[model samples]
Target: MNISWQGVFPALTTKFTAEGTLDHAAFKHNLQAQLEAGVDGIILGGSLGEASTLTVVEKEELVERAVNLLEGKVPVVLNIAEGSTREAVRIAEHAAELGASGLMLLPPMRYKADDRETAEYFKTIARSTELPIMIYNNPIDYKIEVTLDMFEELLQFENIQAVKESTRDVSNVTRLRNRFGDRIKILCGVDTLAVEELVMGADGWVAGLVCAFPRETVAIYRLVKAGRLDEARTLFRWFLPLLELDLHPKLVQYIKLAEVHTGLGTEHVRAPRLPLVGAERERVEQIITDALAVRPQLPDYLAL
Candidate 1:
């Protein structure tokens, strides 16, 4: 299960039952879909996966189930988004023990850590686990940007091998390349800018919309990498509206609704988060419905 640190890795939405329990059946259904569609890896318990609402035991269950299900076809990456260094470390250590192939580590949650604190938070976790880590450098949402200076300090840790570049600035990809070269792999974290980032030399996509449309997502990545931009752009254009849903505050509900339409999942989100309702639900549904009505006939991208 060695991660190649390249290609589409779905920051999957955790499936739950109506009573608010982990829906093992639905979760496995989507995981199989992702694998069958040729995703490079599976990232569990991410922001898109509703990490804040999931219990520690539930997260561990997800890791164990994914490990057993994928069985090494692709790496199972558990995301650590804890508020404290100690809690983050504990989660990282447990993920390693549970056979997670790697970790997607966010900066200190809740309290906005400064540059020094953020670097130390990452360094402590990197030292605590043998598993490789992908720094979730999403300053726009998380508010703590891992600057190039911070990365310069953190790069001494060999395990800090990649980054989820979600700053929404596509140019940052080239900046990262210019600054660090091949030392750290860059995976575009924003769905809308995925192709642009990849074109600018990003190594992979840590995608959100891929949870519902796995084949299209994987096809776009392969097409871009294979130098088939025309076909990729055509498919991506069709996917744009659906992909934009990932940018919303209620993205979990929106994506799960898309999943339901595709029969990949249910719209059963955890509490503090409700399923989309009324005009909002209709709006999101129309977008998904419109996209599905004319879903593109993908090329033989697997053969590419």
Candidate 2:
């Protein structure tokens, strides 16, 4: 499961049973869809995958299931969103033990640790595991921006090899490359800006909406990288509406709903979250329906 992290790696939504249990069957079905759509790798326990809601045991099951199911078709990278360095280290250890291919490590959860503490937390986790790490730098949603200066401090950790850049400022992509060059691989984390990020020289996409439209997601990445801008733009124009769903605050619910329409997943989410209802549900459904009504005929190159 050696991954280059140079293509679309979906930040998949976690499927749940109404009784608040992991729905392995549903998740596997979705994973199969992603694989069939030709994603570069599989990322488990990410923000879209409800990593925050999973217990250690639950997370372990997810990693194990994904690893076994993928069978090395793609790297199964686990996401670490923890509040303490100790917890991050422990999760890193667990991912390694479970044979996860890599980790998407977030800054310490809840507490916005300053530069030193944040760097230390990531360094500690990086040191704890052999798994390659992708630092999740989402200042908007996660609050802790892994500033270029912080990344400079983090450069010593050889295994911290990539960044999921979600600052929402596309300029940061250039800034990152200018600062670090090819030292760190950059993956676009925000969905709406994914194309822009790719155009800005991001190596891959850590995508959220791909949960529903896996083929289209992979198509755009391939088309853009292949310098087929006209083709990519044509597809992206149709994709833009659905892509905006990933930027919503309730992206998890919105995406799962889209997944349902696409026949890859269900709308069952764990609580403190509820299923999308009323106007919200209608709004999302309309978008999915409208998009599907005119879904692009993906080129043969995108087929698995």
Candidate 3:
């Protein structure tokens, strides 16, 4: 699949069975929902997809499964968050071999590399693979900001095609555009700020809450691009509470619960991340349930 990098691309959650194994059935079910909702691409094994916990073999299996399942209708992108440049390059090359359409490359994980080191890390991976790369510039969580100077240094590599703009500042979208112009596509990475960023000239969205509410997510993007702000704002206002679930520390568990309510997935997460319980679970559930109770009637957004 050729990536236009101009629409909704879900940062999909990894599904697990009760015994703590990959649940291909649940994963495929959610993938189908994303496709049916007219998403632009499918991104697997990212932060939301729990990339840290997945073994190398398991990551490869996900890439293979998504590649076969989507079958060229859309691109299948694997997220590479390795700590070593060697391993990151290895995964990039392997993902390309397994027919992944692109990669979401994070800065060296677990180490706070300086600007030069970070740029070199990304440049090395870009040189190693033919697959296009989206630099995951999420400094707030990751601690290493891919500043514009770093982007300038890394721009020589053609495969470093985009940035998942998670700086949590809407103005940064304009800054990227001013510096790089269209040389690098920008996808909004924060779910709560997706619409705001989209309106401010983001090329697309790398969405998290989209795991459960695929249609609404896609609709918001389509409406914004179509210049239907009133409708987009109305739908987004209704979606605000649910979208906030993606901002929590336990976003994986929170979103999995949303998926359960939506019948798109189960809440079985891997070890070190348990299912939500008690008042926390009840509070999140109430947010989801209240939004669903008055779920807005979407416009015929596909027509846009």
Candidate 4:
């Protein structure tokens, strides 16, 4: 299929009921909210979506729910990176069958991978489905790194169309842009460093924080894309503190709390993951309020 995944596509969070059941209504509301807020596309079952904590059936329900609510308003991509090649393949196949736009292949979590091994993993996932795949390269959370050489090899696969580069070293983004150019779209994964990476040369952003304030983020993106670097940097600097929260180890709790505080979405999450409270919750609350209190002005069209 013709592939072009770019712009602000937030990895939409999957909300749950207090009783621990999938809150389909909340999920639909957030998906609709994102599209309404001006995101170019939506990603389901990602780290922000708590996919790791979901069962197979739950994941299926989650993806299908997004598709139903989105109603083809924009593209939808799903994370199929749960450390199993076969299982990920199944998820990819289902995503395609259900009309998803693409797959975000995450490296095997719990351990790091050698360059050659990681290259093979990407190739395997690329071969599994016809849908274009975006390599989810988040070394911090997954503990797996896709080397530049590995990236070179992976991009050769016709189906591996793009990437979500989350490495802290934003310079790597410059390197990839210089090397690949228009061959593969480079999406900046970390919200905190998005402006820096874009300055270095990234086509789009796959951000969690954007779900909370997409209008602001999308405006920043458009400014950069439109050659207004100074304006983008000003917005980025102002929003830097909030973006840093996405890098926190307890990122999920913080994000959900931001959702709760802003009336952006619900903070209810599943077990094995507790709702933030006490000092942690208080800190996250402070972060949310601190960011929203000074919400910057962005362009109006990104909301369309």
Candidate 2 Cα errors over 4 Å, as ranges:
none
Greater-lDDT candidate between 3 and 4: 3
What would the per-residue lDDT of candidate 3 be over residues 1-304, giving only the tens digit for each residue?
Answer: 5577889999999999999899999989999999999999989999889888999999999889988998899999999998999999999999888999999999999999999899999999998988888999998999999999999988889888899999998999999999989999999999999889999899999999899999999999999999999989999999999998888889999999999999999999887999989999999999999999998888888889
The TM-score that candidate 4 achieves is 0.94
Ranking by lDDT: 1, 3, 2, 4
- After superposing all C-alphas onto the true structure, candidate 2 shows an RMSD in angstroms of 1.2
* Stretch of 10 with least lDDT, candidate 1: 1-10
RMSD of 1: 0.6
Output the better candidate (2/3) by TM-score: 3
lDDT (10s digit) by residue, model 4, range 1-304: 3447778889887888888888877777667777776777878888888887888888777767777777777888888866666777777878877778888888876557777777887788788888888898877777778877887888778888888998888898878878888788889999988888877778899988876776678878888888888888888888888888888777787788877776777878877888887987787788778777887766564533
Clashing pairs in 3: none
Cα lDDT of all candidates, in order?
0.94, 0.89, 0.93, 0.80
Best by lDDT: 1
lDDT of 2 at 70: 86
Worst 10 residues of 3 by lDDT: 1-10
Overall local distance difference test of candidate 4 = 0.80
Give the poorly placed runs of model 3, Cα more than 4 Å off.
none
Q: Which residue pairs collide in model 2, if any?
A: none
- lDDT, candidate 4, at 81: 64
Off by over 4 Å in 1: none
